[model samples]
Every structure is written in C-alpha cells, then in structure tokens.
Target: MRACGLVLCVLLLGGCSTTTDPSYYWQSVSGHLRMVGAARPVDDWVADGRTSEALRAKLRQAQQLRRFAVTELGLPDNNSYTRYADLQRRAAVWNVVAAPDDELKLKQWCFLALGCVGYRGYFDEAQARAFAEQVRHAEPDVEVGVYPVPAYSTLGWTNWMGGDPLLNTFLGYPEGELARLLFHELAHQVVYVRDDTVFNESFATAVERLGGARWQATASEAARAEYARFDERRQQFRALARATRERLQTAYALATRAERLAAKQRAMADFRQRYDALKAQWNGFPGYDPWASQANNALFAAQAAYDELVPGFEALFEREGRDFTRFYDAVRALARLPKDERRAALGSR
Candidate 1:
C-alpha cells in the first residue's frame, strides 16, 4: 500500500493559491469520498444472500486475519479491514513515482500531516498518468513511472470513514498474500514516522514477511506449497532488482556521466534479460514482466524502499525475543529518536 496525503491537508491545499495546481487535491478528495461511500460492513455482506461463497470465504478469512493481527501481532484493532468496499476497479489507486533521470533517489512530495513522501497517489488512473506526464514535462530529465496500488493506509486517521475496507481490488488475492497485505497495512498504525518513507515501508514489509511466515507455519500443505512458489518468484524478482540497483549505484559513483549512462542502459538490458530467463524457469510465469519492461530510476527507488532495512528490522525482532508487543515498543522507541540517531540505532545509515 502507498502512503497518501491527509484529507485535511488536501482540502487546505485546494484552498491555497500555490504555484502548483490544485486539481490533484480536488481529485483526491472526490476519489477518497467515493471509496468511503462505497463501504459496508463485512457482516452485511456475510448476511447477504447474493454474496458468493468464495468471496464470503475470503472475507471471513480477512476478518480472521484482522483479529490475528490484533491479538497475536499486536497490530491496531480498528475499523480497518472489518468493512468491505466493492470498488469495481482493478486498483484502489494509481501512484506516480519519479526520480532524477541519472540517479536512483526518489523525489519527495511534502504535505501537512505526512511530511514528505516518496510517491503521489491518485484515485483515477488517467489522473495519475496525467500527473506523471506533467512531472516529466516539468523536469524533462526526470524518470517518471506510474504504477497501480491495490490498497493504501490512512494511518487510522480515517477510522471514522469506517476505516480501510476490504476492497474488491485485492479481495481475490491468494490467502497468504491477503494475510500479508493485512499485516503490512496494520503495521502502519502500530508505528509510523512522519517523513521516512524507506524506514516506514521497510518496517511494514518486515512485519508482513515475519507474520506471513508465522501464518504459513500452521497452514495446510497445499497452501504452503502455493505460497512457496509465489515467494520464490518474489525473491527472484527482488534479487534481480537489487543486483541492478547495486550496479547502477557503482556506475553512478565511479563512472563518467557518459559512461554512467551507457552502464545504466546495459544494466537495464541485462535486468530484462535475466527476468526473461527467470520467467522461463517459472514455467512462463509473467508476474514480473511488466516491472522489468518499465525498469527506471523511479521504479528502482520505489521498490528498494520496501526492502531496505528489512533485515535490520528482522534482527530487532529477534533481539526482542520474537515477542510482538516488545518488538513494537522497541520500534516506537526508535521512532521517537531523531532521524540520524534512529538510523544509527538501526545501523542503517
């Protein structure tokens, strides 16, 4: 899930006369309102005779996972994931990420409550594309990428809006994936820093991976095997991206500008070639093909944020004796520190 601006900030931006246009703010409000208006409690769906058994099962599983998150993982027990929203769309929102054309550093957007975030989200895909195009035009040297997001979190601020609902966009995901998504999103409510996108996302991802592994421990053999296959592909994808990112960093650091450009081209080509090979090995699984095709600084930076520091967070979990409550308290303590001290504490800077 991508981070979003607060509704109040958006409305304030809409009111302000800034150099940047306010259309983005208005669209965000309209889009979010639509989602909030579409939600109904899971109980309502469960009691409906029109609900399909398969969907009902998935909704029930989501509810169970939500409970597990609160009880076992110490995630916030809120209205999120307790309600259902049929968005009637493939993606809840589309996010636009951008970086300098020559570097992997993600551009940040600053807002009131969220401070600075690495990506901007839009409820409309077309609006997202339009914004991305605007960014490209504004900075011709930037590398812009538009990607769809299945879900996002409001940081429990919108619990009054019935919290975050189980949207149709991601309700059909495999069991393990659904559980991981729930765990990851709920982790945001547990501990979040204002502006540290990398730290925030990586922490959530660590929780997701840890919780997913725990959930798989008691899963049926069939489910475990299925998740194993899915995780294998995910790991392969991450390895490829990481290798390319490392190469790009080295190239940028040591090579002349022209040499760096050439190296980047070769690195991307190699990345796609390796992905093709991996896809063939997966019996033609094409889950990651789109990512490879659109490999850019923006995409690379965005993906890295989720995995960076994850190992450190996992180590912290181990240090906390794998106690969920204790681990969360440790994280919160780290969050209370200044940014530099926090990074030093995690040994990540």
Candidate 2:
C-alpha cells in the first residue's frame, strides 16, 4: 500500500516538492494496490511529515552523491530516493499485491494509525515478521533489520538511530548507499511502465547494492561501519525476502481463485513455520535476536522485496564492468525498449 503511494510521489515529485501530504502518499498506495487486486476501502490518510526540510535536504545530499556516482564511477545510475518514494511507489508501478488484498485496506489503515509512512517504499509489519522467521530458520544466524514506520519503523527508539527516524526512506540504507538507492528508485519513477516491480526494484536495489558498495569505498570508517551494519541486516533480510517470494510463487501456482487464496493462506502459514524455525535456529548465534521477535508479515514483505529482485541487478552490475553510471544509463536505455530488448541488451553486455 505504502509502496503504491511512493510510486505516485516519486512520479509526481521531480527534484522539487510541490505537495508533501503523507496521506496523499497512503492514498496513492491503496489505489495502486487495489488496482492490481481488490480495491479496499480506506477512509482518511494519516501519514505525518516524515520528510521535513532537514530530511529533504538530507535526501538531496543523497542525490548529490548519485551525481558523483555517474561522473566519478562511470556507472549508469538510477534514482530511488529522489525518484520512486519507496516500496509503495515501486508496487504502484510494479502491480504486486497482498493475498487477501481486501485486508490491504485494513492493513493500510493500521499502517497510518500505527505510524507507517512508507520507508523506502514499503510499509507493512505483519508481512515482515512472517518473512523474517523464514530467514531465521533458513540462515540460522544472520543479522536482520526490520525497519517499519513509526507508524512503521520498529527500531525507532534505539539510541543509535537519528531523531524522528520513523520511516527509513532508503530501506535502512546509510549515507552513500542511500544516495544510490535514491537514484535507482528515481530511475523507476522516471520510466517504469507497469507490472514490473521486480524490474524496478531489481534495478533500484542493484543500484543500492553495487552503487552503495562503490560509494562505501569512499567513506570513512564510521560510514563504513554503518554500511556494514546495514549490510549485515540486509543479509538476513534477503533470506527472509527470498522465502517470502518463494511462498508467493507457491501461492500463485494455484489455479482457481479459491485455490489461489487457499494457497496464499497456506503459503503465509508456511512462511511463519519457516520464519519461526529460522528464528529459533539463529537464537544461539551472535548479534541476531533483538529483531527476531518483531519479524512479522510486514517486515518479511519488506525484506522479501530485496530477495525477489536483486539477481537481475547483480547480472547487470557484473556486465557493466561494475560501472554503475554506465549500468544506470544501460538500464534507462533498456527502459526505452521492452523488457525483452532490455534482457537482450543485458545479455550482450
């Protein structure tokens, strides 16, 4: 839901801010999600200003880092922060959805009521937990970060986090990676047609990862530490995201609508089973339990995002001589053509 809102925002908001209503963000999300599946009823928008002047300025700094990426790194860069708002934005354009999609309306309300403001595009806690548990069982011992909005972010009270850090607009990314992610998401905002959240996120997350790595190389030890911390969390995050996607695939395999729904329910249950098992498995590992308890469906869904779409990006990164600027340009070029043509270009590259 929040992802949808972000898509509209990023698409609507270029480099400047004309409107900054948080509810507008949420409304966009609901409408987009509903379009793909079932449009649920949402009364009022309740998103507060997660992005203030300070945050906007910070985001712009992140954006400036992107310009450096293109000019300095010679990699093709895409924008996420300045482009696509976050998970919701990507979803709006990509067309993915919740199973009981009707539940999405309730979920969206819960997001705003609870404090969700769409961090890096996705906001839904119930989903992340289910996904995280799967990762815990699968990996048994990796750091995972589940950032929900204040209305969404769970780790908001942590002293280490910055003030009013409710929504993680950059998917819990630190400075440099944040910049890259902004570019990647923006790229999606600029050219994404529809029903290609995977392509959009893959491209953005790829930029986030590869561009982040390149950007990190230029950072100080502290910045590196932040990146290390985020990376560590993302590792387990990826595991859960992978499991969630697999579950979704299993759900999608069902033929009839009833069967599909049943499959969705079963897949969610299985996701819980897998997630719990993983959490228990990782209980003994170092630095791995603080967030396990909060690994709800929303959290899992958030992480699952990365798991499903990163491969395409990895493929692209390797092909572009790891040059992100060129890679960004290449992806934009692909956007000009169709996915098939893009794939062909990638193959040739």
Candidate 3:
C-alpha cells in the first residue's frame, strides 16, 4: 500500500509541472523519494539492537512530542514524526533566495501547489549553490544568498506515503526546540496561504512560540534551563537582525538610485558593527556570525518572511483566547481573504 502511494505521489508531483525547468521537478521528486525511502518506523529503530541508546531515547521523546502536538496544540495527527531517517547530512535542504541590489523584496518563484514563494529549495547543496550562481550571473543587480534549511513541510500532501518522517537533521534539538519545530511544521498543515510567505511563516512561528512555552512549562528543569539559554541567544540575534532590516528598508526607500545604494552600504556597515558589539556581549557566541557576515538584500528579504507579521498573529491568538482551535479557525478566515485585505485585518487587530 505504501509503495502504491509513493508511486501515486510521484505521478502527482510530476504531473503538476508548472515550472519551466523540468530538471527542477525531477530533482524534487527524486530527492523526496530518497528521503522517504531512507525512513523506517520509529518502533523498528527503537527495538533495533544497532540503535544507540541515545538515539533510542530521542526517538521516544519525539513520539511524545508528536502526541503533545496533536492532543494539546490541536496540530494534525498523522504519520509525520512517527518514523525516523538518518540523512547523514548537515541540512535537509538548501534554499536559494535573491533580491534586487537595493530592494528588500525577494524574488518570487511560482509553483503548482505552493503558488509563489520567496525562495527556491534544492535537496542538493551543490545544486542550490549552482542555481544561486546562475541568478547572480543573469542579473548583475540582484543579490543572491544560499542557506541551509534544517527541515521543511509538505503541508500534509504526502501523508499517504507515511507522511513526513523525523530526520536526524533536527531530532536532537533541545526538548523545547524539538517541540517548537514539530508544532511549527504541523501548523503548516493547519493553515497555509498560497503566495503569502509572510503570512504562512509568521502563523507557523506564532504556533511554535506558543506551543513551545506550553511544553516548557511541563518539561524537566534541565530541559527548560537548556532551552532558556538557547532561546535567549536566538531572541537577541533576532532583535539585532530585525533592527538591521528596518534600517535597510529605510535606505531602500531613498529617492535616487545612487542615494539608495549609498545608504544601503552605510546601513549594512552599521549593521555589522552593531552585530559585533552584540556578539561581544554574548561571551563569544558565533552562531549568527555567518548570517551577519553575509547580510544583504536577499538574506534580509528571506528573514522578513519569517519575522514579519509574527506579532500580529500572536495578538490574534490572544484575541482568540489562546484556544488553538479557535485561533486556527480565525487564521483560516484570514487566509481566505484577499491578500491585501488579510494584511489589513491582521494589522488592524
């Protein structure tokens, strides 16, 4: 049955060819199949003698998190995260994002089901970097960035093929972080607005933040303490990034092209200096060094999709009395609205 489902999924993915490049679709299909093929039932791994005790413990914890997502957070209950795969890779996929040299708006890629999104993803890091190079060569005025993605969601499209299995890429996350990542991905299955990357990502992030806090309340003191340190650094880094993005947006809006370009360079330099000072305060934490060093329009634009409108969604959740189901229903209503209207509604709230 699972094999038949996999075949059907391939056909469906292949048949829905909206992109001009057939190779892209082929890579997408093959990459997904390879990952799915590598996965086995979590129970099997837990019982296997070859499975180390450490991995076995993480797998069991993942199941518990999966259950909490469904029963407590009102996330989808499915085969996702019920199985495990070891990709033996640093990242599950690499994403390429590009933007105009002076603009914070990212280039868009349209697809059959995903509609238009800000970034394109490749299962192979080489392919992703190659594509970014192509974009840079073709458009001299475009800024391109390639980044590693730990995980992505299919929005429950391939549930019949055992859903989206947990991968080694993120299974070892701290307990709160693991819960946050799981809740965030499952939220995609709840409400996805095609073409509105900001809305979709922000909504998922809101769910993760809310669910993470709830999970942490019941977590062991050790787990909670670990997540606290991790989250504190993350929050500080995000703040710095957010401030820089705002400065760049102002620079991008300058009247003349030359003025915009000059302002942008100044803003970027100030951003780096500020980040350096922030890093010094962190006692030598370097987690955000790569991102700060490579900051540009494309990177800032990609980051916006995840950060923009998060506060509004968080507020909406509060307005819904923090009931997950009610909040989701409200978000679904917003998703059904025209993009402009949806943004207006979220903003007004």
Q: What global local distance difference test value does model 1 have?
A: 0.83
- Model 3 lDDT per residue over 257-346, tens place: 999999988888988888888788888888787777778899888887777888888999899999999999999999999999988887
| Model 3 TM | 0.95
Candidate 1: where is the Cα deviation over 4 Å? 1-19
- What TM-score, computed on C-alpha atoms, does each candidate reach? 0.95, 0.49, 0.95
| Cα lDDT listed for each candidate | 0.83, 0.44, 0.83
Candidate 2: where are CA atoms >4 Å away? 1-5, 9-67, 73-97, 100-173, 189-191, 251-267, 273-309, 340-349
Q: How much does candidate 1 score in TM-score?
A: 0.95
Q: How far out, in Å, is residue 305 in model 2?
A: 5.9
lDDT of 2 by residue, 231-347 (tens): 665576456656665666566566776775676677667656665665566564433343345443444444444435467657866887876566667677777787576656545
- Candidate 3: worst 10 consecutive residues by lDDT? 1-10
